[model samples]
Target: MKLGPIDWAIMATYFVFVLGIGFALRRYMKTTTDFFQSGRSIPAWVAGLAFISANLGAQEVMGMAASGAKYGIMTSHFYWIGAIPAMVFLAVFMMPFYYGSRARSVPEYLKLRFDEKTRGLNAITFALMTVLSSGISMYAMGLLLNLLLGWSFDVSIWLCALIVLLYITMGGLTSAIYNEVLQFFMIVFGFLPLVLLGLHDVGGWAGLKTGLEHVAVSNGFAAGAWSQSWAHMGSPTDNPMGVEWFGMAMGLGFVLSFGYWCTDFLTIQRAMASESMSAARRAPLIAAFPKMMFPFLVILPGMLAIVLHQRLGAGGFSLPTKADGTLNYDMTVPLMLSHYFPQGMLGVGITALIASFMAGMAGNVTAFNTVFTYDIYQAYIRKGAPDAHYLWVGRVATVAGISASVAAAYLATHFNNIMDMLQLVFAFVNAPLFATFLLGMFWKRTTGHAAFIGLISGTVGAAIHHGLTLPLGSVPGIKGGWLGLTHQYTSEMAQNFWTAIWAWSTCFVVTILVSLVTKARAEAELKGLVYSLTERLKSDAEAWWRRPAVLGVIVLALTLVLNIVFL
Candidate 1:
């Protein structure tokens, strides 16, 4: 995993180009809107690439590989189950709401729709989540750098963070998108050959099937592995993966996708900046195809790596094990590349991996800047601040947010699993907001009082449920555990998952019930804010609907095909 001079050159060149792009575009980012929201001037293709790139971080690549190494094709559900559907739904149902309303931030929409308090609470919640989420993204990139190049984790974290900060501080989202487009192409071109080579190394498709089945039967993996039937996509306990089929699909496909694609600001920022509403709607759809192939590029290689690992004997590319004798799943991708990739190709893949980290950290920093500036600083401290001061504050916040996230990365250095931590964080933070936002969008009766109550109550409810599952003994049945929760508890992921669901349900139901008792906004007040679901866009925007029925049918067909193929 050592880097040669070539690797260093590539990395340096990448950073220099990124910074230059930011400086070159400095003139374009004149106003506060330009600095934070790209002046709403981004083209559809640019927005589309940035949308996908924001989600394609080092954690995602490594996490998918880890899942594949541990669980086989089952990991594909991360996109098939959740990401694809949520994005499609958003495009058809939600994009119109966001683009048509022309709100600067999503939380701003809450204020226009409901009341100021709703906007304030959302702003606070979203700002906090942005910081924490950015931290997790940074930590994952650092983890990747440490594993691939044998660098110190802290040094790697700082190195990645500083480079991203330089460009993002100068160019804002404009530079972020510009660099993302370049990285996206680099990643695809750089890593795809490895996948093709992997299939070759493992022999043909038939040989891969033979290798997979032989290991499945000989190692006493579940009978499902050898069965052509895809009924049980999840690995059994005896297999390397600890979860079942139902768990993987539902977790990745349903919960994670909805949270990341539908709600996360990092990805949404690009869509918000589209040149026109139609262009914005097309951005997410353009992203879906690439997203669907993520598992193919990232996950399948890891699974193949596992097959190669066992064939080479236990001594080859050995990973440090925990007391439970489990292979450190985080190391799966690195170990595989070290073992199987050709020496020359290994260097290319390593460089691409590093590019993945850069892309990820840059995206996080940009999103953090947007939320901190628009949602927190401008909204609260400087409601009437001049454009120049606001831009200065954005630059300052970019640096500050990056620094804070880097600190969080250092804190997360001790955690073993990035996906688990990410999922748990979203469970508490994302679930309630989804309900609140959806209610505000669709229901005319929902009041500011109801929205505030739902937002606070749902978040608090999640905290309580989170506490109960922890080993803190703070609640009688709970024990202290990971992330300052219950210790050594069973099914903590499942517990957190269901707790989040309950939180969302409670918030939605309570918000609705409360609205029933509260006063409603008058017709005049609500006129501009509300839109019918069937509202038609003008001709200019209608072109963005290029083949909606076609896209819907394709998505539904793919969904059913995956479910049937892997059922």
Candidate 2:
């Protein structure tokens, strides 16, 4: 993994351009709105790219490749089933409430639609989750840098923290979103070539498929592991994913996907920063185009890694392995870079990796600062504060959030895989959130107290389901919990899907029953916030193709074709 002076120079050049952008954008931070919401001035295309790039971190690039090597092309399910529909739903059905309600953040929507208690619950949980997620990104950056460049873990962590803090603190969310757009292009340019080169060396898709079937046989897996997606998903024991169609459809596709894509403030903040209602709605739809193609760019490289490893043997191309011979799946992307890329391209690959990491960390930090300063501090601790005072508070919160993230990064070192830990966190925090949002928006009869109770109960159900059903020693990285039942999960991925199901069910049932007993909010107060109460708005001014609903249908149809083709 040695780099030439040319590679070092290229890496240095990328850092200069990124930091320069941050410094250049500092003048834009003239008010709290500018710092937190970009003064609602970003165009649709830029916000759209930033929307997708917010999620295109090390977790996506490195983790998806790892899944490709382990589970084959079925890993595409995480993209197609797990992301696309929810993104489309957000754009077509839900964006009006989010963008039209004048809410500063998602939790603020809860305050307007439900009650302050529900908003408080979401705001606190979200603030904590964002910081912890930011820490995970920091830990990943340090881990990747240490593995690739031989830098110490602490040094890498501090370096990343410092860089994110400087840029985000200076220019706030606007700087972060702008940098995310730049990072998205860097990732596309850096990895598209790697996928093409790897595919060429492996003799194209057909050869790659044959290579995976051979690897599957050698590893005692089904022969179709490389090519099929849903054909082998009839039973939990039939495939490496250990998930059935029902769980995959209802739990992951409907619940988890909607929860993350629609409600998670990390990404919603990008769309909310758009200049107009139409742009806000169009952003996610625009992002869906590139989002659908990422599996080819990121996942194929991991499949290529397997082909290279089997052909070259351990002596020629080694993957990271534990003392017990288990693969450290997170190392897939780095290993591919070391095995296949040359000097200048290698530098670009490394920069892409670092850029993605920083974008992820910055997105979380920005979201956290806004949630803490506006949702928590201004709403409760310092009400009626001047705009300048809140703006200063946001800046101070940025530093504190990054500092907390560094601490969380140190805590994350004990985990085996960053992706597994992230999924676990999502199960605990995000699984039930969409249920709350779903009822709050569509069912005007849903009382505020019911929403609050259902949220707490749903989170509790997710925890209980994981404790009773998830088997001990099933996942490599996480320690098993108590309450072990006779029936155990086949894999962590299965546990994730089922947890969402149970949580969503609990939230839905509890909210409905309790809302029947409790008093509902007045219809006048719910106008524009609830579906039945909100007036229908036309998009005749925009062209047919530019309309969110039209774009959503096109995106969904294309996504369906990809799934069918892959199957």
**Cα lDDT of model 2 by residue, 203-264, tens digit:** 89888989888877777768886668888888877777778888889988998899999999
Give me the runs in candidate 2 sitting further than 4 Å from their true place: 313-316, 414-426, 472-481
TM-scores of the candidates in the order shown:
0.87, 0.96
Where's the lowest-lDDT run of ten residues in candidate 2? 471-480
Model 1: per-residue Cα lDDT over 373-424, one tens digit each: 7767877778887789988988998899888887777767766355355545
lDDT for residue 394 in candidate 1, whole number 0-100: 88
Candidate 1 segments whose C-alpha is farther than 4 A from its true place: 214-221, 225-230, 233-256, 313-320, 342-344, 413-426, 464-493, 527-534, 538-549
> In model 1, what is the error at residue 487, expressed in angstroms?
16
Model 2: lDDT to the true structure: 0.87
Q: Residue 328's C-alpha lDDT in candidate 1? A: 70
